[model samples]
Target: MGDEVKLFGMWASAFSRRVELALKLKGIQYEYIEEDLSNKSDLLLKNNPVHKKVPVLVHNGNSIAESLVILEYIDETWKVNPILPQDPYARAMARFWGRFIDEKVIGTLHRAIIFEGKEQEENIKEVHKELKLLENEVKGKDFFGGDTIGYVDIVAQVVAFWVELLQEIGGLELLTKDKFSFLYEWIGKLQNIEAVNECRPPREKHLEYIRALVENAKSGSK
Candidate 1:
């Protein structure tokens, strides 16, 4: 409710989107500062001195870094629309999956999309395996945290949006309704929520951006 809540982030970053989504879901009013990652702002550097990363949530002059950490901070600071469950084990499970999505799923998806030939193929296999484990974590619930789009859902913004576009750009069919049906249905459920949809970057724009990344990587290799 205070004008003190400020978010320093980039529009296209999945990590940044998670914090933004959490803020929106919590109904917390926060001022957003767009950081030019190539040339980071002094504000970002000053706030998150160690990492100098975007998606730093500065609340009441206190700075919190790392999107997943920020998500938990937002949930704790704002009582309403609890992003993490109250139950201790349930919260731990949600945090576990959120970390898994960030640490495992996203990295595998990135390599699978950007690499080629045997490397890409092998990475894709890993992506499938990792996704299946994540699907099992859902346990037939609409969202990882029961009916609400909570911690895990916010962390998985990449899978729900960017990865789908990345797959098409790479000419790979990774998470289809047929292969990763649970994840596919989960993506549909997450995207239907206004907070998630609004926070996610446009599919076409993200694809173009990723294609440019691949081209740059090729150029850098030469």
Candidate 2:
């Protein structure tokens, strides 16, 4: 018998969307369990004992946490339309960029949007620098790994979506046309993909959520 697959996720999380995109891209049929972060399910807590995070992929009672790891697991297990390149060197490069964005860019963007004062300014500049580096890294490519949408593209799509939402929340336009032309164009291309379009939440809904989050952060409440 095939392994029973279930994904624990939050609808609005980029990490959750990353796994969802990977599953859809690979044409994997699985149950999607929407988790309330405020009241995380017992199964989720058990599956991901360390992080207690969403986007946990459980297969045949074996659970994997972290979006990037889950994406790789999905790609390797399904092996139909491959998300990562077959060549070892190319796959390494793809993994490198994915990790870089996860470690450097996303964190910077989060800090810039969620915090205020000097720390936020520092984070904004740091995120801008990272985007500049990415612009150079993806100079000639349609996607991060060239013409086709692959692992890097999947990672990028979620990040770009959150960045756009954060832009609205912060009421500032950091990713302007002149500053990062390549990323601007790339985000448009990613947004137009059918899978992306289907899974993405409405922009207004995201904005409303962010507004509430900002209010809560200000008041220091749960």
Q: What C-alpha lDDT does candidate 1 achieve relative to the native structure? A: 0.85
Q: What is the lDDT of residue 216 in candidate 2?
A: 76
How do the residues 1-222 of candidate 2 rate in per-residue lDDT, one tens digit apiece? 876999999887888888888888777788999999999989999999999988899998899999999999998888898989999999999999899989988878767777778988888898889889888867778888788678988887755777777787787666777899988888878877888776787889877887787667656732
After superposition, the stretches of candidate 1 with alpha carbons farther than 4 Å from their true spots are 1-3, 218-222
Query: What does candidate 1 score on TM?
Result: 0.94
Candidate 1 Cα deviation (angstroms), residue 107 = 1.4
In terms of TM-score, the best-performing candidate is 1
Candidate 2 — worst ten consecutive residues by lDDT sum? 213-222
Query: Scored by CA lDDT, what does every candidate get?
Result: 0.85, 0.84
lDDT of 2: 0.84
